[model samples]
Target: MTDRAGHRKAAVWGAGGWVVGVLGVLVALPLAARDRLPDRLATHWDASGGPDSSMPFWAATFVPALIWVAMAAAVVLVQWRARKSAGGAAPGWVGATLGFGGATLLGAQASIVRANLDHTDWREAGSVTVWVVVTLAAAVAVGAAALWAGHRARVTVPPVAGPTMEIPEGQRFVWLSRTSNPWLHVTAAVTGVVAVGASAASVGGLTGAEAVLLAGPLALATVVVLCCASVQARVSEKGLDVTFGPLGWPARRWAAEDIASARVETRTAAQVGGWGYRLNGLGTTVMLRGGECLVIRTVKGKDFAVSVDDAERGAALLNSLIGQRSRG
Candidate 1:
């Protein structure tokens, strides 16, 4: 790498470190001013901007801070991995993703703190509807700008393993394999259960406007969790189809005609920059646990790889299918 490129990368890494530090500061800010906060902090707000749920001062203040810290830590970890990745932060979006994480989390929590801090009486609650919307919008704008900038960075495609087998033209075959990471499901389930409990607990005393506010978000979160649980991959004459368990069809499908080549590529957390639906300088990938994956290069030159068992046979069948279309 050139000296200039090395310096630029170092800058990205430094920025990532700063982001972590900033998040820590954000978490500390509310705790520092605890004396002014109400005995019960308004942790959950409804659409009408009223506090729908609250908790004792210390718990409310520290709990969200802990969760935010965890969330920040995760982003920094991913950013660190991406920086250490080949092509000098090829995932480019690392900065943007990190930015979004920091902004969204800190911004939201700051609003919550504001709502509680201004309460004139302990029993009275403050509205945070505007805060929620404004903070989220600001976070998104910052993330988008960061994302666009990250995309401008050089794109890098990792090396792929050469083909080991071929399929004959006369024979026709179908290839299908399904793989799921139990850990992913467990994580999703735990998250869903926690969300349900929290949602129920927060709105227990809420009614009408306040209840509706939390209800929409809780419902949306359940759906998102269900979608993130598992993935399924299928290859046929039509082409490759990958579908998330909850959202079947329409989300992901690549036509056979659009495919340029398919091969069994070795899988590593480093190569895809860690698992679970990843997008790096390489094309999008649905990678579960590490192993070998059938990587497909589309005619447009975009690559899509899925890490699964028995990738060799799957790759061979996909190649054969592509070749058959080429000849016919």
Candidate 2:
């Protein structure tokens, strides 16, 4: 789409999504729950797939609706302002996504509320598994949408200079390593232990099936931490490389000629949301945790950085390789 058209279309979608989502929570939900809202509504859930907390009907409905309204307004306003930036930026894709997804989520929750409003036995009214499924799906959808849109907004494609940065069949090799924080290990260990204890405590609140379903992702997250706790970085005249231990997943290499610059940078979670693999204006960043990073800017202005020890040496070596190759 043309810039003007894309801007208009995105704005319209943002506004409409916010409006529909808010309206669904305010009007559609109330109508659906009509006479069913009990003296007190089920507002919170416990481990056993039962309602453990209650709220007055007005507070239960209005409080959430107010939050949605605020979020929706903020999203639309931010997006509109971001589009006006020099590079035609989109509002923080994160916010746009939340605007879009938050509404959908709140609406979904409203539906669940209406569905599960059986005061006679609120615990038995709705499927806890269903709530989990809807929420996960909504969150994933929002993230996916934001990433796609953000990529379009932030990255300007670089000009290809005819197969740049090709190594002559392993003619040269260089390697280095970067160790992560021991504190990260401690955090992961604590999380795993806490998760284990929580799961055990809450197992009685759910059926055997519910427990298994919920355990799936938590188990996967723990496994990921175990596998990717440390990052090993390597740089060669050929390019740059990084790999994770244990699983050794996502082994990556970049060509030296493609690099515009390599610089030492310190990044924060607020800059790229959270750690792990993050994307922002600079491009893909494989951040293990927040701290010093070696950022490589591509010829196209795209970038990829990683937080690791000895970032200065890595950036210097990588830059020297690029300089030497260009001089050759």
Candidate 3:
């Protein structure tokens, strides 16, 4: 399936699972509490059937579930409207999905506990509600602050709009600004999110549940390794910056003068050998699935290569610029 389809499918599955989980909780609560609470309390009263039961089933579960339903509805509405609009505004579904989906899972767990366990009184439920509200409010505040800061810090970066071949004269340093493939950008974004999320989830203290967090890190590391394929060589007047691990920023730089020659080439997974940045007997390796390479020969008689998308065009551009530099 296409990546977009996959993302949509995952979202649908998550929502579906949440609905199923809610039903499971509803079914299990009655069974789990039958022997523990009186018949009136167990069947007619709150799910727990407790004394001084100030809150009813509808009061706790009904309200939250309705809120979840409303949020989901809003997500659909916003996305539909966004589709009719121009210029890709960050989708409202992003926030709605993250917020409602997360809240549903958490809120459901709290609901189940309150319904099944007598220890979880209305006071505890109130506390949980307060905590959730406070946390949500704090998150909004922080997000607003971050948006303001980002806007304040934002600076316009003009495209490299001039002649493709002409290297600006006497330019001590110039950062390459080029539009990469949209698919690549999407892939990078997904890989980065998975890697970062897994890393965070891997940390202890998240939950007492015996979740093997190490799996997150391992999965993150693997995705990071694969995402390194997108980084095109970054050209500067002094040197070229090539990525090492993941589709993140490059960590290695090779001087322009050190480069003996640059050419466009292709390689298979075998030719690349190993992951991460590997200096094989061939050249500097950036991507594992080698299709196009920007091969560079360092001054030390070692050739380094970075596998980039549209490497031939990139090589030509670099060659033109570098050649211009040599002449001037």
For each candidate, what is the lDDT? 0.61, 0.58, 0.46
lDDT (10s digit) by residue, model 1, range 1-328: 4323433544444444435444454556566557667677777766666667777877765676577667657766776687587544546666677667666666666666666565655446667676667767867886786676455334222212346545555544455555555445444444444343333223222123554566566556645644444455667668877766333422578888988998887777687887577899877777766778888898999988887666777677678788888889
lDDT: worst 10-residue window of model 2? 198-207
lDDT of 2 by residue, 1-328 (tens): 2323433344354445435534444544544454655655666677776667666666666776677667767776777677677455665464446645553545445544554554554444544556566656766765675555445334332221233444344356454645443444444444444343334323322124564556566656655664455565777777887775322455777788888889998888678767666777767777666778888888988888887666776777777678778878
Instruction: Tally clashes: model 1.
Output: 1
Best by TM-score: 3
Give candidate 3's whole-model lDDT. Answer: 0.46
| Reference-based TM-score, model 1 | 0.45
lDDT per residue for candidate 3 within 1-328, as digits (tens), equals 3323333443344334434444444333334443432222211233343333444544443444555566556766676677568342335334435444543444343433433344333433222343345446644653453344223212222324454546557654344321122333344445434433332222211322333454465456545543453343566666677643222344578766666567777766587775446667776666544466677766687877765544564465567666775776
The deviation in Å at residue 175 for candidate 2 is 4.1
* Candidate 3 wrongly placed segments (more than 4 Å): 1-84, 87-209, 212-232, 236-238, 243-247, 274-279, 288-290
Rank order by TM-score, top first?
3, 1, 2
Stretches of candidate 2 off by over 4 Å are: 1-175, 190-207
Listed in order, each prediction's TM-score against the native is 0.45, 0.41, 0.51
Model 3 lDDT at residue 327? 73
